[model samples]
Target: AYEYTLKAEKVCEEGTQKQIPLYDHYFFSILICAEVFKLDSSFHDQAKKIAYKNLKNLKKVQTQMPKNFRSRYLLAKAVIKMNFSPNLKKEISFDFLSVIGVANEDNYLHIEGIACEIYGRFLKDKGIHLDGAHYLKRALGLYERWGANFKVQAIANEISNIQNDDFNKEININSFIEISESLSNERDLEVIFKNILETAITFSNSLKGAIFRRDHNQYFVISNVNNDISHYPQSIIDYAYNSNQIVRIDSIFDLEDFSKDKYFTNNQVRSLLALPLVANGEVESVLYLENSKVDKVFTADKTRILEIISTQMALSIKNAYLFKNLEKLVSERTEELEKKTHQLQISSGEKQTLIRVLCHDLANLLMSSRISFKRLNKKLKELELSDPDITRYLKKIDSSFTNQSHVIDNVRHLELAKEKGFQITLTTVDFLKTLTNSIDTFEQQISTKKINIVINENLNDIEVLSDELCLGVNILNNLISNAIKFTFEGGKISFGLQDDDQEYYYIYIKDSGIGMKDQMVRNMFQDNIHTSTRGTNSEPGSGFGLSIIKSYVNKMNGDISVTSKHKDDFPEESGTTFILKLKKAV
Candidate 1:
């Protein structure tokens, strides 16, 4: 094949041919196909047409073929290229695949390997993966062994591209995730700062490192693995602030050069490098590394690598620093929050105290006024024209007293909720028994309001770990009151119990009450926020009932959320649901 192909190669190379009929042979035609395609691809389709004309010629030469795998393999290669004519891959069959497999599995393992790789690539290109990723794996291994650098690189590039496609579809944690994750443990900023310095110096092969907070005017040796510890240099601490650049020197002589004129040699070392550690755009410190040994010089590569490492070290340390600042911010914010919360707590307590005083005191005052007015009314009636002006003043005084009492009632309700804030007393209480007890307590209110209450019998069986009286009564009272307030005359209020995957036995109290607006839901549990309106029938109570329910629910380490048909665009279906997820008993 070589001898015949070579003569043909020379003939084509010569570019001078007579008797075009003799030149159109299979061997010669293939050489033309290769040459034309190298020059330009359009010629191969032209050459394929010429190659097909000589198939019978290939059949005649099969008798002179060698017993080696080369002939069968080359034949397959020729036909495969031919097969590209008008898309012959679709016309191929099991037998055709077997032939290509044979070309790869035969003694021509070199060519065989390439064929197998190409087959796998064909499958991969068409998204036709076989069992266990067999084809692509085999192709990668075979191509690597074949010493085909370009082909190997191409396959790697494809796999990388596919991996990139997968990466592009993914949703990564944003910068805020890092911010929030840092915020979760923000109090230990100093420890994290020390860790950052220790990690950079130790792993980065620096002899020692330190952190100086410029704002605080304090410096601490964060990490040190110095060889000469007989004397610690204190002048170096002072000198670092004086020299600003990232300092790297080759020898003790170089240090002498910088020390004589550059004004940074006060804390001199034999061969030392220093880089500025920056955080939030300010020079926080100068990080220095020393090689006190006499023989070695820090190479350019070594210094640059150190510089890059320092840059990264600077960034990470800066991040921890920013993290510290954030911690300070959060601390300040949280302290301010606590101060406000405490003030609110105190104010809430005072309001509640005032409510209690108002409750008894104002009730007494109103009664006394009522009595005074009664006596005056009786006396005026007895007198014929009993000071008409005084009569009118009595009526005005009575009206003012009623309004004052109404205001005091609301104040008293807010005070009770503020003082009792979700009274949490954990005990293993029977869920059913406690719930039934709470229901029994509200029987008077239910009867007075003429609202029908329905409790499923199943609520009589479960046990829960909670402050049964405080938690149960608060939930039942708020939900039942809501139900009675919103439900029509004959509407039903129901309570149900169940277990959920969160390991909690739940007591759900849902009501047929008027639903709330979406915007009001967020502020529902926050104190000092007014987020209520009149009920369906204008029955007025301080909106402290639900707020009291929320306070208790939170103290129990449980959660309560309301689901209503509220929308941004439409009025709701006029019902609210209370879903209480409580920690279940063991």
Candidate 2:
């Protein structure tokens, strides 16, 4: 891809198109070379130089594209700086944080995955395997969703190796996760600043604190006390802000050189520190802290943690700004739509509009929560602790978020049904392949219940006419879930495929578990009838899955039926079987 793009660039430079817009191609070339640099150490030197030149070219024409592309550009910058430009180590964290924040905000999974993977590798090379593993695992999840199976396998292998080490550092996982979630959930800038100051004061044992944000060439002060800049010494703040470093003083009066300085001479302060918050290669803010009575309040370990907090603050601030801008854009778009479609907005259209708005907002909220989880995972890794219990808890948390995502998908599909009336495009889908993937979606649940899945025969060559999304996510997925829900531990769920006639094929799923009454099974797909029953484990349902499945099946010109005998009536062979008949694609 890189070579072909480079050839195209040369051809365009030779006057075929005269000033062709190849920035996107250049951006991709940078990414390809950057990945090569990451995977192969031998290509580091050449890859870095090539990627760096492309980055410079990208920067020149960045304004011609949408602001979202800035995240990708920053990612490329982080890759080059992390692997090749060692002198810019101080700026590496900021670059990665900004890239991640923007990528998460924009829902750019691939970009986020690449950033996390490279960041993980960077941490691993620094001997922080625990944190590296956390990032690699995050990258693994993102890649899996992006359908990059090869990359997912590679990252999983990397995470396994990292976790093999015996790391048992004690950490307060709940507290850190809470802090990260609090910061990530809030988009109000003032609230975030207050939280940052309060957390910094409490953790660092400071009497009072203030934050000064750099704007243009001036600094604006925000403090727990009065907004007076004179309340705190400006000299240390200036030094930290100008130099982009932390300044810690044990005692102001102890330094002989400071005796002439008016603020140090006049004040009774004992300990003071000024730390700069840098993001995207610039100083964003300065956090000034003081202890009037105590000496040496800011210790090394405290400072180290505070530095990490500063990085978090920078990321939160940038993300908040991004969200603010996006909200403005959304408001503008909504206003335009309202004006243009005012006459056409009927009752159904109004409901659809509301659903669209809610879906968009809910998606943003879910993304924010996921970002907080990633941050917490990163912090846990930073602690160098490798506890199985913590990992298990994290997985549970991740699973819950994934469930929320599925709910969002179902809601979106509901909106689609409302608008299109259960419309579906029938395509020739491989019957066995689709069924296998659908079953794999419930792999965790299946494994948990120790259920055996049996396929009657190989139907790899068979194809059926159906909508892929409807068949995979909506129909087959829901049916499989229902089977797993009612199926007892160590039960069996079997699948069989057959051609009942020249025009149609039959697919049957049978589960050997508790079955419903015949009358209830007959009315299962009725819209007004509530046929949902608690599973063996008392699992709850929305009572709408069957009706939706029936609608989708009818839309695809298919038929579905169920047969079952109650466990009380037939003790030896009580089970439920669902038979679906669809057209056999030629």
**Best candidate, lDDT:** 2
TM per prediction: 0.30, 0.39
Clashes of 1: 3
Query: Tell me, what's the RMSD of every candidate?
Result: 27.1, 24.1
What tens digits encode model 2's per-residue C-alpha lDDT throughout 1-586?
A: 6457668667665764424356666667787886677678887777677787888877766556536567778887887777677557569978988888889888989989989988888877776555666677678779989999999778766654553444322124444444444454455677777877876665555657999986786667888776777766777677788889888887765556345556776778877788888765677789898866556667666676677667656655665665666566556755554555446533556545755775787688669757756875786688676777678657866865775687577666775664567556789998888888788767778988999999887465778898876787778888999999999999999998745688988889899989999888878987544466788777655455787787778778898989997899998899999999988897
TM-score of 2: 0.39
Model 1: ten consecutive residues of lowest lDDT: 166-175
Residue pairs clashing, model 1: 104-112, 247-274, 422-552
For candidate 1, give the lDDT of residue 261.
Answer: 42
**Judged by lDDT against the true structure, how good is candidate 1?**
0.52
Kindly state the number of residue pairs that clash in model 2. 1
lDDT of 1 by residue, 418-482 (tens): 56543446887776676665566455456655666777776675666677655555565466666
